[model samples]
Target: MTSAPSVLVVLPSLVAGFLACLGLIVAIGAQNAFVLRQGIRREHVAAVVVLCTAGDLVLVTAGIAGLGPLVASRPAALTAARWFGAAFLAYLAVAAVRRARRPERLDPAGTASGTERASRRAVVLTCLALTFLNPHVYLDTVVLLGSLAHQQAAAWAFGAGAVLASTAWFTALGFGATRLAPLFARPRAWQVLDLAVAAVMAALAVTLVVA
Candidate 1:
């Protein structure tokens, strides 16, 4: 049984973890953009959200398990991830640019043609690549967050808070994106979105190569 005093002692750690994770993930990044696009398209939203949240959970757990330092020490591993991530981002940027050049209006019924709707396996794989291939994911979730978790009064509590934050964020981003469906009904809107995605992906790729 836990005492009230003990709960109080760990409250700060929990809050700190939650805020830290929320701060890190709230930014618009490749993963978030992908999820938002899927949500708007109403394709495989549940799977994408689940996979992303689970990925964060696994990475956060690994960090709490003290794998951060070990991973940080492996420069070769980071280099491999960086290059692969950069290549993937570059490819995605090109794809987005093409889409922007030839925009497609979204169906109001949320029912895209067979060609437009990507397979679940493909979406899952892409989500995995976006989550795992980026060295920044490891650096932010594993190395940086892990170090911060250890600084808390209760490390596991901090980890739990982090996981909760991840779950909440993905849930909101994936499910709440439907509200924008009306906006995406216009082909021009989609073009704008694809262009934005292209720019973001390209910038990330460049940063990875230079860093």
Candidate 2:
């Protein structure tokens, strides 16, 4: 059998990429807030996790393939992305505020009965919009993570490591946050969470608009 990949050859780059990506991801923002909310509600957890991770992988690949310079040079494209992101965030803010005012019942069967169950397609589309529409996500995961990783290893290997990191991080976040589901069983708790989500989305929207 061929020799196993050497830690010396792989570990440093992988660790670096993981840390870089994690640093970018752990910031309290629209995406993280939305994911945390979904996790707490235990709604379409797998689909949301997979879609988010996959979106990051695609963006990271684009950056590794030298798309960063192109993205940087296109001011109009970035501007449009920012505006679209702001609009999406605004929509989320409104939804969250409404939920905060009138909290949803947590009875799983009841929730499932009302055509309120989150579909996989909806989860995927939401994640794709959140990840791709925000120029910040592209700049962080694609340009920053890609550039940093590529500096430490070959383009393909760096991309591979970054993608792996995204998958691992999002999977852990989606499942790990589920442990807090019990806390959200109370409508009051959900209202609080919804208010927090609304604040985060609005804050991000303001930042996007200003930037």
By TM-score, the best candidate is 1
| lDDT tens per residue, model 1, 1-211 | 9754388868888889899999999988999999999988888999999999999999999999999999999999999999999999999999999988888877746465622777999999999999999999999999998999999889988988998999999999999999998998888999999999999999999999999
Q: After superposition, how far is residue 76 of candidate 2 from its true place, in Å?
A: 0.8
lDDT (10s digit) by residue, model 2, range 51-148: 88878888888887888878888989989999999999999999889878877656544443422666777777787788889989878877787678
lDDT of prediction 2:
0.79
TM-score of 2: 0.90
| Per-model TM-score versus the true fold | 0.95, 0.90
Error of 2 at 143 (Å): 1.4
Which residue pairs show backbone clashes in model 1? none
lDDT of each: 0.92, 0.79
lDDT of 1: 0.92
Candidate 2: misplaced stretches above 4 Å?
A: 1-7, 110-115
